[model samples]
Target: MRTISHGISKIEKGISILLMFSMAIVVTLAVAFRYVLQSPLSWAGEISVFLLIWISFIGGSLGLKYKSQAAVTIVVEYIPENIKRMVMIVGHICMLLFLFILIYYSFTWILSPSVSYQKSTTLLVPMWIPYMAVPLGLTFAAVHLLSNLFDIFQKGESQ
Candidate 1:
């Protein structure tokens, strides 16, 4: 379980780092070209936009793995430690369920023939190519949530 959690965290971090760096490069080149050279790459914007989507979804999972999702922690701060842990476990369970549903529906949408026919306006790439990031990221987040829940359960036992 520890190994799985660690591996998922590493994978999430690696993809996130790559996406952020690539987005910076893509946006920088797009800006430099449009302003400096007076010619913009049509594909650049589309690629960057899609990359942003991927970044956002992947970052969401990373946030869950790190337990950094912003909520009014004030509410839980005063609660008893064990109770707080249970509350957070429930929260993680909710996150897992939501991600599962999203992945299921998004996957179906991705595989639909209509989706296959749709293409990005500028890049003309199949829309599913960009859409796939949603399920992939959500699935990773789901796995991380499960792993974290396991950790929390064991934590309660040790305490």
Candidate 2:
């Protein structure tokens, strides 16, 4: 479980960083081409937008793995340790439920005929490619949370 947690941390960070860097480069090039060179690339905007969508998902998973999401933890901070452990378990359970729902609906949505047929304007790629990000990202986050839960319950550790 620790090994899986460690591996998720490494891969999540690496993928998020790469996505961020790619977004920056792609958007920069699009801006430069549109304003300076007077040659706007049609695919540039679409591609950049696609990258941004993916970055949000991949980066969001990393945020889950690291517990970097925003929270109002003032109340929890003052709670007892055992109670806190219970709260943490409940919290992770809720997130897992949410991710499961996300994965289910997103997967089905992608399989739907209309959504599967839809394509991007400039890139002309199937819309499912972008929609797939929902399930993929949520799945990653769910696994990370499960890994954390294993450590918490079995090893008596906090996330």
Model 1 spans > 4 angstroms off: none
lDDT of 2 at 134: 78
lDDT of 2 at 130: 77
Model 2 reaches what TM-score against the true structure? 0.90
User: What TM-score does model 1 achieve against the real structure?
Assistant: 0.92
The stretch of ten residues in a row with the least summed lDDT in candidate 2 is: 150-159
Candidate No. with top lDDT = 1
For model 2, the superposed segments whose C-alpha errors exceed 4 Å read 155-159
Worst 10-residue lDDT window for candidate 1 reads 1-10
Give TM per candidate. Answer: 0.92, 0.90
Pairs in clash, predicted candidate 2 = none
Candidate 2 local lDDT, 2-121, one digit each (tens): 677678778877877887888888889889999999999788878877778888888888788778999999988999988988898999999889889888998888899999889999
